[model samples]
Structures are given as C-alpha cells and as structure tokens.
Target: MRHTVERAMAAERSRYRRFWVAEHHAVPGIASGSPPVLLAALGARTSTIRIGSGGVMLPHHQPLVVAEQFLMLEALFPGRVDLGLGRSPAFTAPVRRAMRQEEDPPDRFADDLTELRDYLDGTGAVTAHPVSDRTVPMFVLATGQGLAVAARLGLPAVLGGPLLESPDLAAALAGYRRDFRPSPRAQRPVVTIALDITVADTDEQARALVLPEAWAMARSRVTGEFPPLEPVAAIVDRPWTDQTRRRVEATVRHAVAGTPRTVRRRVEELTERTGAGELLVTTSTYDRAALAASDTALARIIGG
Candidate 1:
C-alpha cells in the first residue's frame, strides 16, 4: 500500500492535473484510520496538484478541528488545497459508535461551516494561529437537498450518485444556477459531478475489474459487510446466481467502466448533458497499476 501511494504521488508530480484522496473507514480489518498523514505526504511531494478528501465526512469531526487541519494544509501547500465536506458517516453504525465522541451530533455543521468561513477569513472570534486569514476554496459534497443549500450559498458542490437515482444532472445544475445567490467569492455556481470510472485496454478487462467492486457493494448493501478488496478472479470464479447478478447489476449500472474509447464517449456525453465545470472520477480497485492506467486513460479522454 505504501509503494502504491508512493507511485501515485510520483505520478501526480509528473502530469496529473488534479487528484483527490477518498476518506473512509471500516474496510475489512483496518482500524484507527486517518487520511491526514497520507494527504500531508502527498502535499509535500507534489508541487501543483490539487488534493483533498473526495470528501471528509463533516458529521464525524469538529468544525474547528477540520478547519484547523485544512488550514494547516493550505498553509503548507497554499492555493492548491481544497476542502470538500460531506455529511455521511462513511461507515456503518458500529464503526460510527466506536468513533463517536461526546460532541458527535455535528448538528452545528451548517452554522459551523459559516463560522469556519469567518475563521479562515480572519473575522471570527478564534483564528488559526499559523495560517490566520488564509482563505482556501471550499466545496460542499452534496446529494438531494444539500444541493439547495449549496446553491443558496453560491458554494461549489460536488454531486455524487448516479443520475438515475437522484435529481437528473441537468435539473440539479439548472436549479443551482437558477437559485444561486452571489457570494463575495463566487457570483455563479461552480458544479462538479462525481462519477465512478474504470478503464482498461479492453472493455472486457474493465468490466472484469469492476465486477469485484460490484459484488462487494452488493454484499455491503445486503449485509452491511464492508470488506477489503478481494481478488477480481475470486469474484469471477464464484457462482453469482441470477438473483445476485441482478442485484449487483443494479449498483453497477451507475458506474462507467469500459475501454478508453467508451469512457471518453460517456464522459463527453456527461459534459454535454450537465455542462459541469469539472468531473471528479472515483474508481474502486486494488491494483495500483490499473488505477494509474485508468487515471491516464481518463486524462486522455478529457483532453487534459
């Protein structure tokens, strides 16, 4: 895992335009997880790449702590840091209970987010000592009604989930643009859509890689068992009865996986459909080489 991270860091230094590290816990056997160390290391190595949690689940941490941590990161990297905040716990109840503290309600997120803005701007009661008055770009990672909140605040939003499951991308973007209120920082809505993408030399190869993720996700949905990446061959070799295949297909349908050509076409179609300023790509896989290859393929497709 360390080697994979090192290679990814090296690759980011070479040519990647933007990179995001996802934050999650309860992956099979891992415990006491924290992404700050990994993110800090990546920040130190890369000169210009934009890095942040695909989202740091806001409901799990104190706003002040989050603000301070991200403020420190922005101080270290300046101008290249982003803070993407989301509301989901990113784990099941047991894990949440284990991690829960006395101040876990996080009900102050909306108010706290406002306060964080003030602190970062150097106008709040308390300020980050080392990085006082430093402002960094903040994005709210939203689904459903959270879009309205982002739109009203004129904050950029990263929309997740498939178009089929939620408000269509076109409608959501249109709504945000229509209802957007101008803030001092942004006069218009900045929209970024998140999509699951997997690419390989051939469509079949890409599909094969995605099958394990699909199967795992299906199992999670049914039993709430979040496990580490199992071998793709293992998933393929196991008998997926018709009922299981149907369940897995429902989840997989939202993802875009295929050869480079197919990925390019789908991404282009999404761009045309939503007019999104950016598209955030998320891939689920255990192979670092394949992950890097997938990112390269996406860059080519997006003409980055």
Candidate 2:
C-alpha cells in the first residue's frame, strides 16, 4: 500500500497537477488505517502536490477531533491541505452503533459544518491553538441538500455523478451559483466533479477491467458484501447477463472506461456540460502498474 501511494505521488509530481486521496476505510478486507498514513507520507515526499481526502466521512468522527487532526496536518504541510467533508456514515448500522452509541442527529450536519469552520478558524467557544487563522481550503462533498448548505456557506463543493445528463448535478451547481454568499476565502462558486475512470490500451480491456469494480459496487449497494477487488477474469466469469449490464450502465454512465482517446472525448463532453473547474478521477484496480498506466493516459488526454 505504501509503495502504491508512493508511485501515485511520483506520478502526480511528474504530471504537475494535484491529486486527492480517496478513503475507503469501511471497505471490508482493505486496510483501514492506510489513508491518513499515506496522505502524510505523500505530503512529506512531494514538494508541491496538494494532498487531501477526496472526502472524509464526517459522520464517522467528532467535528472537534477532526478539526484538530486536519489542523495538525495543515500545520505540517501548510498551503497544501484540503479538507473535504462528506455526511455519509460510511458503514452499516451495527458498525455505526458500535462506534458511537449516541451519535449526533443527521439534521445537525449544517450546524456541525459551521462549528467545524469556527474551530478551524480558532473562533469556536473553545479555542484550538495551532489551527486558528490558518487558511486551508475546506470543500464539502455534496450529492443533495448538502449542496444547498455548502452554497449558503460559500464553500467549494465536490459532487459525484454524470455531468451531461444528471438533472440533480445541474440543479445543485445552479443552486450553489445562485445562492452563494461570498466569504473571505472565496468570492465565487467553485465546483468539482468526481468521475470514475479506467483507461487502458483498448476499449475492450478498459471495460473488462472496470467490470469487476462495477460489479462489486453494484453488489455492495444491494447486499452488504464488501470484498477485495477481483480481476476482470472473475467478473467475466460471473453470471451477469446483458440485462444486468444495461441496468448497471444506467447508473454508471458517468464512468469513463475506455482507451485514452475514447476517455478524453467523454471528458471533453463532460467539461462542456458541467463547466466544472476541476475533475477528480477515481479508479478501482489494485495493481500499481495498471493504475499508473491509467493515470499516465489520463494526463496525456487532459494535457492534449
């Protein structure tokens, strides 16, 4: 895992762009503690690449503690930390109950988000020393009503969905632009779209690589089975029929899984549709060589 992260960091540096880390702590069979450790290590290794969580599931941690941990990270890395917060519990009911018996109500997310900002700014009723007055950017990961809250606060937001055909994505971005209240940190709305990408040498290979991850995600959505990612061979051997592919494609159309030329054409279409200023790419393969090849292909696509 450490080596994979190091290679990713190296790739990011070579590409001269920022990359955010995706944390899947609750994903069964994966090492849970690797994300934070990997982020810190990447921060130390790279001189200019910005390091951040694609999002941290905020409901899983106390806001104050989260503020402190992120503050420390920002203090060490200074100018390169981003805190992307998500409201999902990121686990099953039993796991959530075990973690916090008296978890705060979900309705309190807006208030908690405000308080977290205050704590980070050192203006909360209880002061935090090192984090006060620091200028690390905070981004909210929003899919629905959370988008409205982020806009009201004038913070940048990241959304996961299809850019071209998603009415929800259009509505959320419009709401943010319309209702945004200018803060000292941001005078204008900032929107980022997270897209699932799996690039390979050919369309067939890319789709083959994506099927296992897509299948696992689909199965997990229905059943709670969180298994380690399997190879394309395993997915091809599964009983999923063409009907299943059509069903999954309805929800997974946002994913860009094909050759670099094909993926780039889709990405260009998405950019025109969303007017998003940034793109976050997420891949699900386990092999470092495959991951690097995909990222390299993406870089060429974007740069062209």
Q: TM-scores of the models, in the given order? A: 0.89, 0.89
- Per-residue error (Å), model 1, residue 205: 1.5
Scored against the true structure, residue 236 in model 1 reaches a CA lDDT of 73
Off by over 4 Å in 1: 1-4, 10-14, 29-32, 101-107, 163-168, 241-243
RMSD of 1: 2.7
- Tell me the lDDT of candidate 1: 0.73
**Candidate 1 pairs with clashing backbones:** none
Candidate 2 runs further than 4 Å off: 29-35, 101-104, 162-165, 241-253
Tens-place lDDT digits, model 1, residues 278-301: 888777776767877787777777
Clashes of each: 0, 0
Candidate 2, clashing residue pairs?
A: none
Q: Give the range of the ten consecutive residues with the poorest summed lDDT in model 1.
A: 29-38
